[model samples]
Target chain A: MTISEIVKDILSKAEIKNIFFVACGGSRAACWPAKFFLETEAKHMATTLFTSNEFVHATPVSCNDHSIVVACSLRGTPETVEALRVGRERGAYTVAFTGDPAFLGDPDYALARAGKYMVPYRNSDKLSCLEGNSVKLFQFAVELLHQAEGYSGYQDVQKGLTVLDDVIAAARQKAGPLAQKFVNAYERKDTIYVIGSGPSFGTAYAFSICSLMEISWIHSPTVHAGEYFHGPFETTGPDLPVLLLKNEGATRALDERADRFLAQYDGGHQVLDAQELCMDAIPEKVRGYFNGFVLGSVLSDYLNLLGKARRHDRSVRRYMWQVAY
Target chain B: MTISEIVKDILSKAEIKNIFFVACGGSRAACWPAKFFLETEAKHMATTLFTSNEFVHATPVSCNDHSIVVACSLRGTPETVEALRVGRERGAYTVAFTGDPAFLGDPDYALARAGKYMVPYRNSDKLSCLEGNSVKLFQFAVELLHQAEGYSGYQDVQKGLTVLDDVIAAARQKAGPLAQKFVNAYERKDTIYVIGSGPSFGTAYAFSICSLMEISWIHSPTVHAGEYFHGPFETTGPDLPVLLLKNEGATRALDERADRFLAQYDGGHQVLDAQELCMDAIPEKVRGYFNGFVLGSVLSDYLNLLGKARRHDRSVRRYMWQVAY
Candidate 1:
């Protein structure tokens, strides 16, 4: 069956509430998106846990016959496999979605089924790596949500999928221009601070360095929201370029408040967000797979591209230090 | 009564099995060691939570009137106080550990009746920041455990109290020599990979950067003992510095097995339990916290002092991002 059909099947057996969505990294990175999406679409939060974050002290949520462990693995990673085995041993129903059925347990029927479908589309057909496969699995979850709710918003979800592609394209296109802008304007700036909260935080981390500072070879700090109050609030100055990730989701309000505080930060250099900028052109309905991370990357990529006029190099990041303890 | 007495009295009257400790940042950091020390001494563990970490979705651990909530404060942080109020509403016993007792509550009767002991000696004060207070609280908990368990190794806990200081002194002493070593040896190293698991994982993270590299400006990455079999295995190379945090609290067998696999890791380094190094010298209970972090810090700090020889400047790191949806 298609991944979406499989999700719908699981939900039907879930008795409207038996599914447990396990997670590790933020869903935006494309590993798992159902946690936030389904919770918003349904009454139950559906339970979430970083695959590796289990505690022997005591488990707040149980994995048993009454539950379904829907684990997502892009490469059929060993840890993910072990986690599924753990759930099964606890008497829980288990279903795994992966691009590598061989790496997955050879449960003949499931193996033949997942290999014939999920892998061909996400791995071979698209030539996507584990990362791309992660995105597709998340896409599958989003598709299933559309079927169960019959929300008539399936098209919106499809558009959201397209938006991810658009964002990636936009990142590449804007890289050069933004690099020049940073060079001509904020080139000599001492320290740039990138800030965001929730799922958007990871995107901010990768882009601030990989896209902007790395591309431009500029030094910067990416911070968590509300952290400015702790001590970094003092780092604001006339020469600082602060990139605030403004996205709409559960954290929109807090993000706005953070933006408000950051606006007054550092003598007011450059502050960009949804309401204050023209990101409407970016696309919407980011219900799956770091869809926003893709969108936000465009801004950082553009900033870095624009900054290169001043001799910044994208490949050159402050030597990524490996601290040996 | 003193801080120690107040904590002890609060424990005597409470059924800690159901207690849940809640606080924020440094305050939460201050209390966790207490839970570990107390649990080991009391032969039980209390449920612990950090407010900021719960901003997304927190595990709703079970608790009731028989439970106690110990809120810690440094300048009466808002979240810690708020958590205490929440606990009271939930029918849980409440306590507050703070630098300023006046801000703990209105009448301060319960607060004042406890922790009243005096230490008039001017030099008797324990340091309160940068994990100083954390160490003091932990050592005191060890002392409390010794008293409760009738452990004859009270002096060992006493020695444990000074381990950090001793490590610090050692760190300072080798600052010159190790700096030169790290400068010459790691001049080409780029990334740091830190690895440890179980209770030590927290400390592994603490030292991975804050206690290790941050103290010395080295780059490090920490992982669980077995996690090396996952994606990190692919990332391991000569360009990285993999610091294995070997400890005894969990299981020596698992650690030994991990040691067998280190030959493939190009950036591999080992931090054997200091219990063996200082076995006859220090007490068993005292060996837990002192050997890894402090000694690692000493080593890393020594490396930092050699920054000039390496010709590379390092900056302390801050929380850069989170996954935003």
Candidate 2:
């Protein structure tokens, strides 16, 4: 079934009073946009995003038959599978986004097929994480909002989805040269503070841990732009390498505030404002929602360049999947 | 009014459908236990924790007359005051936990008196953050649970609270020597990864950003223990400095897993297990709930010793209140 059809059918049968977005790492970060969208748009419906194991260990008291649990894993993460199982046990309408059945049949994915509704998203040699994971999960949210509330932004979301690929391409092209410049100047720097706010903070978080740390072996820590002044801003210095992202969201002012602070205190900092991306193709009404897509794509460009300059393969890992973690 | 009396009065007049815990920095971290408690025990009411600015910028759609907004700050953070004002404008019942009225009357706190209900919490020369902030916030939660749901664990919570002070003192004594050893060995290291899960994660977060970074000028980033294996564990190595906290909550296994990995791969990591703390005075049933209090007190010892060793006064700051963004 199409995402719309699946959501419509589920809405017809169950009164989903709450949503639990469960995953880990990048997938957990990806859950942010959907949770933010629902929190902002969906009245009377509560939503939460949780790390998979935390979800399983301390399952929300509200996770009942009336809850919808969306669990994501690129290749059947064990905790995600268990989290889905826990959701199912609680009689929640459970959805899983994972690799193909053939991949799930591997020993590593022994219990991956736990979702009541399995939505297979491919992960191959190439990196299509944004397209495969975040976009698909967001489609679920869009479909849910449409079917449940006759959300007026449905058309805007559809238009955004249609032009999103082109927007991502444009962003990648625009960011490529800038990323190369960044790599040339700051190639030896070990620590970078990646900052953003609202929905864009998800991308900043993903880039810091998944890309900079895991992929490029750089010590990058994420700080929410709104949260920067609270405590993390104290660590800022003249030589601090800060990568700040700005998006045209309601919380854009927070990101701009952090950017302004970094501009004053930090010399080795870069600002990747979503305004620089060619998002004219996306509808103006919903451009804010698609900023994550643009930011994720552009940050991927930066990470790829940094990885290449440091002679590190993005796929290379010393502990992940190789060791019995 | 006392916390119990205040919660009782609030409950008497209105039916609160949801709770929003709004704050920034350490105050925001203090909201976790209350939010966690509601998520775990409250069957119908929903709860969310938000950074104050984000709460103001993208207010939740559910913030209606039936919503309870609990805003926290030591001396009225500007964003927090704005957040409470937004909550009040939305017709939600607004509560504030700020400093005494005299301190709040200063020019810096011009807009601090935004909440419909103001609860004074003190911040004197000594460090009483856990007591003045987290403990008070948690009292509101405990009273809320007892009043709203007639929670059977009320007596356990009461017993736990009665012994919490002693538990904290015992934890401090036990942790002081270990912290001195830790400071002697790893004081020069600039980066430390602080890890925890469940409610205890709040303490880890507070210690990392508020104590380590803001107070001691050390580079510390927080990682949830459940989130460690997903991507962050890849960044762990032999020479890395890791400060891991373990609690008796349902998510303790996650912390133990991260602790095991650190033990094997890193020799410099220090583990502060709640089980080691003298929590025997607290009720056995609610011991897990007070682990955060014990952990916070013990971690404060570590941070204090480290601050002394580095010759960095905990009060020293380059940008906090000295500069404007």
Candidate 3:
């Protein structure tokens, strides 16, 4: 079934007053856009994003049958699977997104099968994040909102989806030289700080955690654009490598403020403004909503080039999967 | 009026379906304990914590007459005051916590008077964080839960509060040696990653942002204990200074996992376990609830010693109030 159809099926089962997006690592970061979407667009339904194990460890007192828990893990992360079980035990309608159903017999996938509904998606390694859980989870949120309240932006979102691939392609093509320039300039820095706000933060988080630290073994940390002035700004120095992802949404001002400061105090900082992405294909009113998608596409190119420059591969990891907790 | 009385008055004004804790920097970290309290303890209400500026820029569509907005700033931060105005404009029951009432004539505190319920509290500079917005905000959450649904732990919370000062004093005295040891070992490090989970995270965040970075100009980033494995663990090296604040709550296991890993990879990392604090003064059932408070008290000693060791004054700031954003 299509994502919207699945959302419809889940909503028809019971009244979902709240939605919980549970995952870990990049998968957890992927849920933020949906959480942001629900927070800004849905007036009646409450939403939360939780790390998978935290969801199981402190299952909310309100997580009963009235809750809808959506969990994602690329290849059935054990904690995420356990979270699905915890949600199911709470009598909440549980939806699990994982790798291909062909791997259902694997121990991780086998346990995740216990969720009420399971949806398989393309792995990020094989496809860009734009085509992976980020977009799918957001589609779930959009559909849920549309079915629940007849969201006026539903049509615009559908139209946006129709042209997202072209927009991402154009963005990736345009970002190649920028990514090369960033790698040449900041490849040797021990730590790189990424900044983003609003929906663009999820993409920033993915780059920091999944690409920079996990894959390239770089010390990269994400600082929310809004929160930069709070404390992270103190870390700014001429030698610091700062990457700012500017959003085109309401929180753009926060990003712009950070950009201005970076220019003054740390002129070497890099910024990838979503406003410069090829978003003309989407409706002008809904273009802001696609900032994450646009930025996520460009970030992939940046990460790929950085990995190559550092003689690191995206598949390299020291402890993940190699070590048991 | 007492905090409980204020909460009661707010509740009587309208049916509050959700609460938003709006602040920036340390104040934003202060709200997490209350947000966590409501998320885990309250069954009928939703809670969200937002950076003050973001709260003003992207105010949730759900924020209305049925929403309760609690904003905090030691002396009326501009963005926080703007957030209070936004909440008031949305017809949210706005509560503002600021500096002493005598400063109400100051421009900062003057504009903050626009909040529907202005609450003046002792600034952190004069008192401990335990006696400042941290405790006050959590009290608001506790009283809110008590009045809304007669929380069974209300008596325990009150009991906890009665002995909190004594517990903090004893913990502070005991922490002096540990703080000195940490300062002597890690004072030269350029960056320190503070780790914590559950309520303890708020204290860790405050230490990282308000103390280490803002005060000492040290590069410190807070890594959520549960999220450390996701990516940040890659940054673990023998030379890296890591401070882990262990919670005594359900999420303690997450912190323990990080502690175990840090022990193997970076044996010099310091840990301030809340369980070892003078928490015996409180009931065991509610002891975990006070982990943030307990650790917060101990952290003051750590920060003070670190500041003296580095010859950096906590009041020193390059831009905070010296320049415009």
Candidate 4:
């Protein structure tokens, strides 16, 4: 059976009430898009995203037989695998998304016990272009909602996913030259502040950590636009590197407010608004659903340019895969 | 009625299944400690912390009459006030924690409608000490848990709160000279990474934003220790300034792991361990409960020193109080 069929079969048997997206590092970051999808489409289902270690230590009472735990790890790190095992022990319907099914070893043994699928990507070493992982996760989420009884709008979401390639192409075309310009101007900056709101907040966070800090070795922190004014705005100055991502949603006003604030400061500030991209394929009502994907795609292109400019290899790591904690 | 009595009364009336601790910026960071406490002591209660704007826009389906919304804002900002109003409208029991009863305007009109109480503190402008707000929030959480009928160990929590003054004094005594030294070394640095896990994560976040960024105009981002090696550790070097807060809890191992990684680099790294401070008044069994408070107090002292060294007044802000977003 295909991954979707397996998930459907599992869901059909379980009386799941809560869902947890669990992983560590970039794996955890990759879960954010799916998290946003669940929040938007399946709000009735209590959903949460937790780092693998934290989840293991502070295992919520909700993580029982009535819960579904969806986790992803590119290399199937020990911590993440342990978390999935713990979830299974607690009687949760465990689902794993991974690039290398064999990386965890005893794949057949694990699959027999919990649902597992391999992410359709060959170059697992590269940090850029998480579109494949994100696509699979979002598809799984939409399928889960569709299989569930009360959830609405999954049909629109499935339709949108079918045409996401066109959206990605358009976002890349607009982001290419701008990414080069941004990379050239701020490649040497000592620090940067990346701001976003709503769905784009996860993209901002992932880009700052997975791309800027990990790939380019830059000091970048992602701040929520809605909360930017409360404290972080004080760090703004003429020399600060600020990157703002504006999404087309009800939370757009919050990003606009941050933009207005940054306009007063004579700093190196850039705003990547989702409305600027030509997402003609996605329906107007469902465009909000793809904000994270579109913004993340554009930011991923910018990060690729940054890696090229800084002479940093996206796959190179000092301690992540090298040393044991 | 006293705040504790009012909270107990409110708890008695509500059939809450889940709880949301909502606010924006520093206020949101403030809710995290209480959120952690709830997770530790009352695992049966589903709890979450969200930014006020996000809560307003993507109001969760679980946020109905079966939910309790607890929020805090020093001045009761517009976003927070709106969130509280929305919670009340949704029939969720709403509680507000603020330094001033009139800060939200028309105490009789607002508090009379939603349960509101003033945090015991004067000089609300001072950003250095958030003890009053933290104390009130944890106290409210403990009292709520105590009145919930099934939760255990509320008596120990209450006893610890009674002797918190001793903990605060001891933490300050140890933090004062160390704070001066840390500020003198890193006050001029371009950026810093504040790392913590578990209960200390909120303090790391709040100190980096509320004190370092807002008051001293420093660039710092709080990184969760469990997730630190996954990405941000790649940015570490001899010159990088890293501050780690070690809590005496199940998550302390995560912080120790980060400390070991930082040791390989000659970065201006510092660790403020809660166990290092002499807290004779706090019982050994309950020391974990006050880890957030102890670490936050010490870090706040360091921020105060940094503000003094940098000649930055904590109350002075370009936009927060002076202008609107």
Candidate 5:
């Protein structure tokens, strides 16, 4: 059976009361969009996200026969495999999303589905691909929830994704010059602070790690915009580079407040507002649901410019995949 | 009533099936240690953490009459106040841990308890005091869980804290020289990567934000040690300064693995292992419960040195209290 068919079958048969997104690092980061989807779109389903190592150490009490564990590992790390093993041992249905199917090694455990996708190019080249992976994960979540619990928002999400294709294309063009300017001005800066709120915060986090830190080998920390005032705001000054991702959602006010503070301080700040993007193709009601995708696309353009400006190959790494952990 | 008595009374009456830790920034970071404690010690209780802004935007479905929302805001920001209000509206038992009692401001809702404590010193001076606040929060969590759900590990935790008071003092002395050296060496470095796993991750996050970024105005991002290998590891090289906090628990292996990788690459890396400290006063079975406190105390020492070496007063903020966000 095809992967989607297997997923559907599992959802139909299993009495899934909760969903656990289990992975580590970037993979764990990847789960956030889906988590947001589950929380916002399907509030009835209990969803939890855990780093693989932590999950293996202390499995959640909710992990039982009526639970579904979804894990994604691009490289199929042993930790993730172990987590899946533990999930199965607890009688939870297990599923794996991977870039390399061979890494499964003929697993005997009850893995309902192993969705495989081609590995994307390494480094900054992987940014766009990672976004695609996010979409895949989000779509999978929609399908599972829709089938199991009859989530009504699944169609809206599908429509949003359809509109997002054009939205992303336009965003790339519009963000190019800003991305270039940002890269030129701050490529050599010691550190950058990336701030976002609402659903877009996860995008901020993924961009900081996958694009700025991993791909460009620059130091960037993502802070939640609302939380920025509590303590992190003290780090801001005329010299600090702040990237504020403004999403048109319930949390937009938080970002606007932070942006105003940054403006007052005259910090080297850049605002990437999803509301500024021409998302007319998407209905205003559903636009909030796709803020993650729209913002992610704009940030990817900035990351591309950064990679080009620094003359650093995103794929090249000193430790990752070059040596064993 | 005394704070502990109030806490115990509230816990005994509330039917808390789930617990939510809701706050922003530093306060949010502070909740993590207790969240870890709850997860490890009271596995039967479902615990969810949300940044105040996020929590207010979309309150969790599980947050009902059978839930408890515990929040801490030193200044009682409007966002956190809103979260507490939302929790009350949802019929969840609400508790506030704050530095200012007046912040509650003639509360009309059903706030089970408002545990007020003396506000710490402002600026870098506040860092040490914040550690005390964390101890208070953890203690509240232990007492609440012990009274409400009868967790078996309460006495062990109490024993751990008894020993931790002395351990923290010893750590301060032992960490002084090392902290001074680290400060002198990296005070001016472009960025620092702070990594920790298990319970210590919260300490790493707090130190990075409250100490390095907010207090010292340094660029530091705390990463989960278990997630370090996924993508961020690619950024590690001889140029990047890495600070690894090794805990004495199930997650210690993750930190040691990262340490080994750092050692191999010969990066400017420092390992502050909790096991290295003279924690002989803590029993083997209960030592893990105090890892966050021990590591936090040690890191606080380093923050003190960093503040001194940089000649930056933690209390001197350009925008935090000077301007409204």
Candidate 6:
């Protein structure tokens, strides 16, 4: 059977009344759709399940013949493989998906999802779950929405994929509108802090590693911006470089003036405004998030690069986040 | 002058051209109205901005004399206060509002928008921002909008707030329906994870601390349900309890399934099927967030209480966040 057909089979299967779909970061994104699919499919049950890292350790009980661990990973993260291993150990059925079966072995449902390298570090492994293999993991589950208990509406599981893709594409275009400015603001600064809220918070978490700490090896810290005002502000000074997620979600007056009000001795500041309206304006549902984030990412990328370009900046933690532990 | 009038004073005097507001976790919920306010106030030249903890520290560079730091904190967290302090030291005028002034002075613009309390910890402080502060922040900014640059239209701003408040209030009622279930879920789990996205993320962040972690002392973890599927899934098990924020702006599929699929584990689960339609169901605007979070928080409180009552389980984390330094 094709990927969708297999997903449909899993959707129709009469097992695991309460199912939890797990995955790695890649699967994490796909879990979005997987969630819709499972919930929509199993709406009739008391509840359908989905979780990632936190759940594996917490482990919610209640299992039956249907209880199984269906995990996904584009690269087959150790977490996914381990989850499947645990599922089998627990007498639950397990299905693992990956670009290569080598990660889990032949019996594991390692879907041939990987593609050629899109760039140097990035691989264009386009998994065909939906728009992107990432989307597919969830979309495939969404396609099973018809099976979820009490689920009434036949939600066009693919309703907004195209739009989302467009949005993401558009956002990616403007990825870092204020990268240089952030560096310029804190010319002599030694540390960088990235603040975000909601969905952007996750982006902020990854951004710090990729944008500055990873590339330039700068000591950057990510926080839930609201927490900064709680008490962390005392140490902030010209030495701290502040970058605000200018996404159009929850940040407004806080992001704008929060930095401006900092004491003159406070670190430098900038706003990476990836306004969501522009993100919401994507034509096709598929590009939605890509467009929304692309532009802001560009700006973010620039800030990290700008610091490296300056060369004279010696305070950069050459091995930021490079923990020996 | 009223807070609105004072905002106008600052905008005109500061010659503020662009403004961005920075908030954290739950308080970041203000981003919605703050954005509306800045755009309205500037007429054209100045736009609004919002960022979470991660972004504020990494990539914000755009600024002008008009720049100000408007920090929000109910608890006066160290990082946030320090961030604000950093802003002030950087020569940016700082305005802060908190439930407790132990670390801060009284609010001249608004006298402690809300009061301090321990039962709810700093959760009530976040409520203060949600109820009227966020809207007022927007309205105050709107009053400044006229000929600042080249923008006009308090119409959009007002409408947004009106709709936002009403929707938020209505959604707040979920606390009533889910309160008992929340408590019940908490009773059984060893660890609790609050999963959310978009505006709901802040709300979820608050629940993790106040409900499960702070008050109840449950081992609660807050995660972007979508992102949790990545690496965090390693933490899951049959006893983990989870709360899924069923708001529209989340990474849809993933969040919806979080509660139910999580239920399968028998660890524990609560589904806060909060819809935007329920936002206006709130009795008082000020009490909106407080009321909204009640059911879920109460559940967390109940769970924490139950665990302690049994002396069988311990709370999630000793501290909300590790100092990490």
Q: List each candidate's DockQ score.
A: 0.06, 0.76, 0.70, 0.57, 0.51, 0.05
Candidate 4 CAPRI grade: medium
| 1 versus 4: better DockQ goes to | 4
Assess the local accuracy of residue A266 in candidate 1 as a C-alpha lDDT between 0 and 100: 44
lDDT of 5 by residue, B51-129 (tens): 8878887666668777778877766667777888888888877777665333322233222233222222122323443
Indicate whether candidate 1 or candidate 5 has the larger lDDT. Answer: 5
lDDT of 1 by residue, A1-325 (tens): 6666666666666543334444233221343244435433432223343333332221223345655566554454444555566666666656666545443233343422322223222432123232354455555556655654554556766665555555455544544454455446666654456766555554665444445433553344455553333334343444457766665554555466666665554445454443433334433544423534444545545554455555655444332222221
Query: Local error of candidate 6 at B154, Å?
Result: 5.8
> Which stretches in model 2 have alpha-carbon errors above 4 Å?
A101-112, A123-131, B102-112, B123-131
Q: Look at candidate 1 and tell me the lDDT of residue A122.
A: 40
Q: Candidate 2, residues A26-133: lDDT per residue as tens digits?
A: 988877778778887887788889999999998987899999999888777888889999999999988987655555323454334687776666543244544466
TM-score of chain B of 4: 0.90
Clashing pairs in 5: A123-A314, A123-A315, B123-B314, B123-B315, B124-B314, B124-B315
Write the number of the candidate with greater lDDT, choosing between 1 and 4.
4
TM-score of chain B of 5: 0.88
The best candidate by lDDT is 3
Please give, for residues A57-82, the per-residue lDDT of candidate 5 as tens digits: 76766688877788777656778878
**What TM-score would every model get versus the actual structure?**
0.54, 0.95, 0.96, 0.91, 0.87, 0.41
- The segments of candidate 1 whose C-alpha lies over 4 angstroms from its true place after superposition are A2-28, A32-48, A51-61, A100-195, A202-223, A226-244, A249-325, B1-23, B27-72, B79-197, B208-244, B247-325
Clash pairs for candidate 4: none
Interface RMSD after interface superposition, model 3:
1.4
CAPRI grade, predicted model 3: medium
Q: What DockQ does model 3 achieve?
A: 0.70
DockQ-based class of model 5: medium
Error of 2 at B87 (Å): 0.6
RMSD to truth, every model: 9.8, 2.2, 2.0, 3.4, 4.5, 19.0
Per residue, candidate 6 scores C-alpha lDDT tens digits across A1-325 of 4454654555566544444566645344344334423422342221223334433432333333455465665554554555555555555545555544332233333222121111001123122213334454444444444444323433322445545545544554555334455656654554466765533554565555444443444444455555544333433545456676754533444454455544343545666665643555433323222322343335444654565666734233322223110
The TM-score measured for candidate 1 stands at 0.54
lDDT, candidate 6, B156-196, per-residue tens: 43444445534544444445445556655556554566777
**Residue A325 lDDT in model 4?**
55
**Native-contact recovery for every candidate?**
0.00, 0.69, 0.61, 0.61, 0.64, 0.08
